[model samples]
Target: PEQAEVREIPAYIIRLQDEDIVAYSRVCPKGCRYLNYIPEPRKCSHCNTQRGRDLCCCGFAVDNPVLKCPKCWSIFDLARKGQILCGRAPRPPVEFKLDLDGESIVIASLQERIW
Candidate 1:
């Protein structure tokens, strides 16, 4: 008689709620929740606690890092008012000159420098 051997399988952490399957990286640990930073890291990575309310003051480190104000250290919420009031106006179109050397032959000329 031959003995049965046990096979090892990869373990996965999954949650089933209302027929919805949510999967998380098991690498962190047995228990952990995703921390939403919104404009940045809103909670401590280890504790997963809400550090502070959204004051549009404390800059988040997750999204649009360049949009943070260095002086105040907060996320730039330009969309709060329903529109952005910053940015330069559009520039005027440039005009070009062309020279026809011969029949069916076209030559284009552009300005080299602006004075």
Candidate 2:
């Protein structure tokens, strides 16, 4: 589905092609650092030889969007909801159930979270 991002909410929002919207928490479970929505990892010349866990091949696989932890280098798949798509580090940013009301998206409930 085509991805259209809407930042009206404080969280990461992805507007689907089907007119449905989904949101995810932006807190990193590893170190409680704020997570950012990265559409794709920037592949630079030096990223290939980087020794620290900053960037890697899995970071390149993020085609749509993924939540990335700046501290522990953890990555969470938006589609998988708190599950580590590549690296294992999720304080378990949960999926909040939303209720759409015209132009507003309301938080209906929160998904059960786990570390």
Candidate 3:
């Protein structure tokens, strides 16, 4: 049987939400096209210690709603398999970052801001 042509969507555009919690796609500091969003503060996957929580595309801590993964360099989604191909080889493992800033702030109010 012929394989069906699958349409591809930007992983960074994926929306992850929970009861009162939501996350958007934040650009990877590494400059990868992939972005991630979590509901709390987290360390960067590349730097392993750098925090990009609630930061904007400028990489600053603001009332931003988009966040990205530090490792796989992917925007955490129900579709992510924890393994992403960058150029050719797979990327290293890393934790995801979340955006939490204020109350009723869909840009940050991810239930509770993670530092």
Candidate 4:
């Protein structure tokens, strides 16, 4: 029997090439409940409804490394501590320190680098 290696955490998880786990807040800081995830380059569905502009939240994994906001088009880099690549986000998303115990993952502390 094959055991499930992937477990869902409360936050948005990104598994790196080195098997390192990085987590971020799923909620966009720009006052939107739209959950961010790894997706191909395309126009955001939510933003598209409001405006006729094609906005991209394209960034996930090692290949594409920026998570753009669907609402304001704010871009955040996943590689460099989730720093703001561009756009008006006030600050980067909140990153949490994770710890693995057996098959369970726990959030140790909240990284408050961003306001």
Candidate 5:
């Protein structure tokens, strides 16, 4: 069978093991891609750092439950509405309200002011 083409979505959806769904913007607040690679424990492909560097994206781990920006090393909590755990980002990533309709998830509205 032929493989289906993979297209990039405008946002990121994180489904926890408990069936809870959370969504956030793909664009990082620091003007970089939020998650350009498969998130690993304390590993960021963009920063290419193995050591514990605060200025690198090597802290966005699923076990740690945070999303780290590769450019500025901003940390965002995945459980607490993408709250800023730490770093230089002036604001958190824009979150989108989602509604499940039958088999599809719809973007209801923006949770934060864009402007």
Candidate 6:
């Protein structure tokens, strides 16, 4: 999914593999750079293991990429607890719980802390 905003904050709404829907702050805490939604066959997942076709640094040529950290080469796999896979970030992504309205997802409150 592309970057969308919640209450003007950069965020993304992701539908997990299990069909569960959730939201996360797309802003990287390391430098506040927007995280790229890079799918698998990724360039890399961390600093030491380079397994994918391209390095996580390459922001080009990726189709449906997972959330990747361009500044510190960190990658986030949505299937997990949305942890900071690598790099210098001290915490995981901030999660925002969504509510199901009449055929819509709604954000009804403001959260100032990281989940």
What C-alpha lDDT, on a 0 to 100 scale, does residue 5 get in candidate 2? 39
Query: How displaced is residue 113 in candidate 5, in Å?
Result: 5.0
For 6-70, candidate 3 gives per-residue lDDT tens digits of 23422232233433332332444355555545433233333343453333222323222334454
Residue pairs whose backbone atoms clash in candidate 4 = none
Report the lDDT of model 5 for residue 6: 23
Q: What is the TM-score of each predicted model, taking all chains together?
A: 0.17, 0.66, 0.22, 0.65, 0.66, 0.64
Which regions of candidate 5 deviate over 4 angstroms? 1-8, 36-50, 53-64, 113-115
Worst 10 residues of 6 by lDDT: 56-65
Evaluate model 2: give its lDDT. Answer: 0.62
Worst 10 residues of 1 by lDDT: 81-90
Better of 2 and 5 by lDDT: 5
Local distance difference test values of all predictions, in order: 0.24, 0.62, 0.34, 0.62, 0.65, 0.60
Which candidate tops TM-score?
5
Q: Candidate 5, residues 23-82: lDDT per residue as tens digits?
A: 787778878766432335455544564354535644444554566676766777767777
**1-115, model 1: which lDDT tens digit per residue?**
0132322311121222233222211111112222112223234232343453333333334322112222233232212210111222121111123333543212243323242
Could you report the Cα RMSD, in angstroms, for every candidate shown? 23.4, 4.7, 15.4, 5.0, 4.7, 6.2
Q: How well does candidate 2 score on lDDT at residue 58?
A: 46
Q: Best candidate, lDDT-wise? A: 5
* Candidate 6 ranges with C-alpha deviation above 4 Å: 1-9, 41-65, 109-115
Mark the regions of model 3 whose C-alpha exceeds 4 Å error after superposition.
1-7, 11-30, 42-64, 69-115
Candidate ordering by lDDT (highest first): 5, 4, 2, 6, 3, 1
How do the residues 1-115 of candidate 6 rate in per-residue lDDT, one tens digit apiece? 2343345657777776667776777887577588876555244344344454345443333333357666776655566656555567766566677787776777655345643
Candidate 2 lDDT over residue span 1-115, tens digit each = 2343355554666664344577777766665568877655554232666563355534355445567776666767665554576555735576788886675666677767543
Q: For residue 81, what is the lDDT in candidate 4?
A: 75
